[model samples]
Target: MINITLPDGSVKQVSKGSNALDLARQISEGLARNVLAAKVNGKVIDATLPLYEDAHLTLLTWNDPEGKSTMWHSSAHLMAEAIELLYPGVKFGIGPDIENGFYYDIDFCDYDISEKDFSKIEKKILELAKEKQTYQRKEVSKADALDYFSKKGDEYKLELIQDLEDGQITFYKSGQFTDLCRGPHIPNTGFIKAVKLTKVAGAYWRGDENRKQLTRIYGITFPKKKELTAYLEMLEEAKKRDHRVLGKELGLFTFSQKVGLGLPLWLPRGAVLREQLEQYLKRVQKEAGYEPVITPHIGNVNLYKTSGHYQKYGEESFKPIKTPVEGEEFFLKPMNCPHHCEIFNSSPHSYKELPIRYAEFGTVYRYEQSGELHGLTRVRGFTQDDAHIFCTPDQIKSEFNGVIDIVQQIFTAFNFNDVIIQISLRDPQHPEKYIGSDENWEKAENAIKEVAEERGLNAIVEYGEAAFYGPKMDFMVRDAIGRKWQLGTIQVDYNLPERFDLTYIGADNEKHRPVMIHRAPFGSMERFVAVLIEHCGGNFPLWLSPDQAIILPISEKYQNYAEKVLLLLKKHEIRTVIDDRSEKTGRKIRDAELKKIPYMLIVGEKEEASGSVSVRKHGEGDLGTFSIEDFAQKINSEVNKLINY
Candidate 1:
């Protein structure tokens, strides 16, 4: 018998060779029925995978993210089966479960596929799903695997098999279709009761521009019909909130082919909106004792080499610029920390000034492929609200908690209440892949976990998600439409200080390395704005709105009053605009509503004489007439409530 430990610290003695599914059956029949996968000793694997020794086991149900992933991943295989039944002689490429669902690339030699075929394809998938075929996993020798695909005329699988070692190759068979995979799939096709094929697009076989283009089919599946119905509704809502559509409609930001594919040109309105977000964070940082700094858009190649970013991310960075001096080169800066580290080195510090926080809205560049660029979110160049905190090892937990407070405040101010926290630690099995001593890595990871628990965060801890340099915490924000986006991140690093040879005087009058904490509450200005635009459906918060209020005249007769109202609002520093054109008041109101202005003020002859304006709120009806001072004060009060942090 072997002792199996569960998540809640309970242990059960079970016979060796008992798989996760058997363990689940021992616990409860319902749990066994719901188990999609299992995590064995921190590795997610098939529920049917047999255990040879004692280890920690966690049964994954549909409620867990990994469970959902396993379901979606299995759904991809089910989808392939359906496609092969409908269209034979189709060569398949890689198909992996994405954040929302899954996509499989196929080389349809003579057959053409598009969105119009989605209905029949989805129908076939559900039809096959009802057959309730179990997904059977079998290990095969590479020579046999190659022979199987060779006879089947699937070069894609043959190519994959050639790269894999002979003894480690495996194949999964579901229904009449078989594919090469190393999987933790759900038990059977019956788990997917409903399906939707969302998109059909063209993709290069291996993401190489020179490779043959293949058709990629995107799809999602659910355990119940009602769940699928709800998901389809969310997709419709997401279409209405897509950032590109909202960006164009709201006149916030734009892209120009002349400017470049992945570079965004911020319009005047978008610039004003960005400035407001920056100023709010600046105020918060100031109150928190952070010193603001500015850095250039490019840095010498050697600078990154010393910081080790060049070694890790040099390929993704833009091509280096050659100078008149021989062998002198500079790169479009791919990170902000390397420069901040230099700033810390510029001045010597004593033990009295142990913790120093440096903040910057630094722009960095990467050469993102054209296929990957999506408006401002995936731009080639963007500015990060980046900062680094240098403190002693003893200050790690307190400083991390302080930064978490700031992150929480930022989320609250932006109305992002649905927040998910992830604590990523170094992989224990592959210690050589990470920098820093084991002691420091353990201390940093434990500090994050303890702080998260103390603050009642209900965080998820994932091993091996850490950067090569350090352990980290990531904040995933769910927008208004229930779509998750990773926006804020904080990493604790012991490597950079050692790499830079950074030191400060300790209380013992000796030199010691200061641990560096990397943080960005907004992640990047461009992507954050993109997420925010979709989060609120283009209706920005009052404080962040470019035009807080617009003054409208009943007719040309009231243009003078409109101008007076605009002037008064401006005197109170309210972002107000005037619709003084020769148009009807109803037309003016309609236009202002489309612009998403928070407050609309109508000024007529009665308002000119009494110095009062008629008020109407966007998405809400009128609020009678108010004196200009009262309206401005009310608006100011609303803005104040959002920025107390």
Candidate 2:
């Protein structure tokens, strides 16, 4: 007998060859029926894989992310089988499960596929799924794998096999289809009761633009038809709230081919919104004892080399700018931390001034592919609400907690109550992918974990998602339509200070390295504003709205009173504007509502003589007429209510 430790810390004595499914059955019949996969010693594997030694096992069901991945992965195979049946001689590339669903890249020789064919393809997938074909995993040698794909004339799989080791090769067979894969798949195709092919796009082989572009089919699946129906409904709602569509409709931002692709051009209204967000964060940072700083948009190549960014991300950065001086080159800054590192090195520091916070709304440029760009969310150039905190190692936890408080305050003020935190750590198998001592990495990771636990955050830990220099905590927030977006990040680094040779004088007169904490609550001004536009549906909170109130005149007779009301509201620091156009009161109200103005103050014959104004809230009906002072007080109070941090 061997010992198997369950997630709840129960040790069970079972036969050495017992599989995860057997253990699940031992636990409960209900659990066994729901088990889709298993996490064995932190590695996800097939539930049917035999376990021969003592191990830690966690049974994964539909509620677990790993289980969902396994289901989606199996769904991808179902999709591939359907595609092969629909279009013979179609060569496959990669088909992996993504955050929402699965996508397969296929080189369809002289075949055309589009969204119009989605229904037929989805029907085929469901038909195959009902066959209840078990997903059979077979280990094969590299020579045999090559022979199999070579006989099928699939050069893609042949090329993939070239880089893989012989002994570790495996293939999964489902129904009448077989594919080369190292997989932990669902038990059978029957688990995917519902299927939907979401979209069709073009992708280059291996992500290399020079290679042949293949047709990429994206899809999603569910175990229940009701769940699939609900998901489709959510997709419809998401389409209505898509940031690209809303951004254009609300005149928030735009893109111009002449200006360049992946670069966002902020219109007047969008600029105002961006400025308001910056001002709000500026006030919060000031209160948190942060000092504002500015840095150049480009830096010398050597600066990045010394900071270690050039070694890790040099190719992904914009092409270097060559100068008249021989061999002198500069790059559009890919990150702001390096410049901040140089700033810290500019002067000597003592223990009393140990923690120094530098904040910047720094604009950085990256070389994002045109196909990957999506409005302001993914852009070539964007401004980061970035800040770095330099403190002693002993102060890392408190500083992290402080940063968390700031992030929570910002989210709460913006009415983002549904926030999820993710802790990202380095992959242990690939230590060379990261920089920093093991001791420092452990300390930094532990500090973030402790702080998150102490603060009682809804946090999940993910390995192999960390930055090259450090581990990070990221915030994923759901918008009004339940579409999740990554908005905030906090990272701890012990590498940059050492690279820059930064030092601080301790109380004992000994020199010590200061630990670096990098954070960006907004991630970037462009992306945050885009998410905010979709979250509030362009009906911004009063304080953040570009035009807090609009004064409307019933006729030419009451134009003077409308102007006076606008001036009175402006004098009280409310962003007020007057619609002086000679249009009907109903037309003016409709226009103001379309513009998403928070409030509309109407002036007519009676209001002109009475020296009062009629107030109407956007999306909500009128709140009654009041004097200009009372209206200003009301607006102030409402704005305060929304902005109380």
Candidate 3:
């Protein structure tokens, strides 16, 4: 018998050559039925694979993220099988599982496919899924893999195979269809009860624009029919809350081809929303003993080179600007930390002033591929709510904890209570992917891990997700609609300080390198606003709303009363706008509702005579009537309640 350790610290005595599924069956048949995959010794693999030695095991079900990913990945294979049966000789590029579901890129040569065929394809997928087909994994030599795809006229697979070594290549076959994949698939096809082919789009073969474009069919599958139905409904709701659509409808931001591809132009209303967020963060940082600083949009290329950013990210950065003076070249800043490091270097520091925090709302630019450029989320140019703390090694934990507190405050104020804290560490297998010595990397990673434990934070550790310079802790927030967004990040970096030769005189009267902590509560203003717009569905919190209240006169007769009410509300610092348009009262109210204003104040003959305003809350109409002072107090009170933290 061999000992298998479970996640809860229980040990199971199992016979040699027993698989994870056998262990699950030994525990309970019900658990074995739900088991999709297994994690052995921290590596996810097929549950049916035989275990030769004692190992740590975690039985993964649909509830576990890895289990869901494995299911979806198998579902992608199912999808490809269905498509192949329907359209003979349909060459496939790559099929992989995504965040929500899975997609397969195909070179649908000479075949016309569109959204109209989604139902047909989905029907075929469910038909194959009911067959109880088991996915068979096979290890193939590189030569064998290449010959198989080359004979099938699939250059895409052949090209992918060339990158793999003989022993490292694997292929998964299910339901008369086989493809190259490194997989931990679900046990069988019968596990998928419902299937939905969401959409189809054209994508370049490997994200290279110069490569041939293929049809990318996106899909999602669920174990139960009801879950699929609920997911479809949520998707419909998501379309209505899509930031790009709502951002334009609410007059927040826009883009133009003449201006640029990924650069966003914030309108007046959008600027106000962004400014409110900035001012709030600025106030919070000021209270936390942070000194604000400014940096130019462009910096000398050598600045990034000295900080090791250019060497790591030079290809992704915007092209350097050539100056009339030959060798002097400037590049649009891709990061704020390098410039801040230079600022820190300009001034000498002593141990007495060790923990120096510099904050900036710095705009940076990058060269995002045109195809990958999204409205605000994936943009070429955006501003980061960036700050860097330079402190002694001993103070790393306290300063790190302080930043976490600030991050929590931001999340609380924004109503992002459902947050997942992830501690990202470098991949031990690929140390060459990152800069810095192993010693510095270990110190940085350990500091973050220690801080998380001391703070009692439930953070998941992910390998190979850290920034090139250091390990990081990222906050992934699930929005109101259950979509996850990575909103905040805090990184511990000993590399940059060493690379920049930054030093401070210690209490021992000796020069020592200060550890750097890079943080951004709002990772980027554009992405945050986009997530915020969708999180609240454009109904912003009272404190963050562009216009807290709009005064709508019943007619031109009460326009003066509207102005009076607005003035009174402005006295209490309420953001109020008067809708004196020649439109009807109902029309004005409807327009304001569409704009997602928090409160609508109506001034008519009675309101004017009584020196009061009628209130109607957005999404919850009719709050009766109140005096201007009472109404102002109500708005201010609500705003204070949200921003008190």
TM-scores, in order shown?
0.83, 0.83, 0.84
lDDT scores of the candidates, listed in order: 0.91, 0.90, 0.92
Stretches of candidate 1 above 4 Å error? 1-78, 91-99, 105-112, 126-194, 201-215, 222-230, 322-327
TM-score of 3: 0.84
Model 2 lDDT tens row, 430-521 = 98888887887888888989988888988999999998889999999987777788999999888899999989999999998999999999
Q: Looking at candidate 3, what is the lDDT of residue 304?
A: 84
> Taking the tens digit of each residue's C-alpha lDDT, what string does model 1 give over 345-440?
998889789789999999989889887999889999899999999998878999999899899999999999999999999888899999888888
- lDDT top scorer: 3
The number of clashing residue pairs in each candidate reads 0, 0, 0
RMSD of each: 5.3, 4.8, 4.4
- Judged by whole-model lDDT over C-alpha atoms, candidate 2 comes out at 0.90
For model 1, what is the C-alpha lDDT against the true structure? 0.91
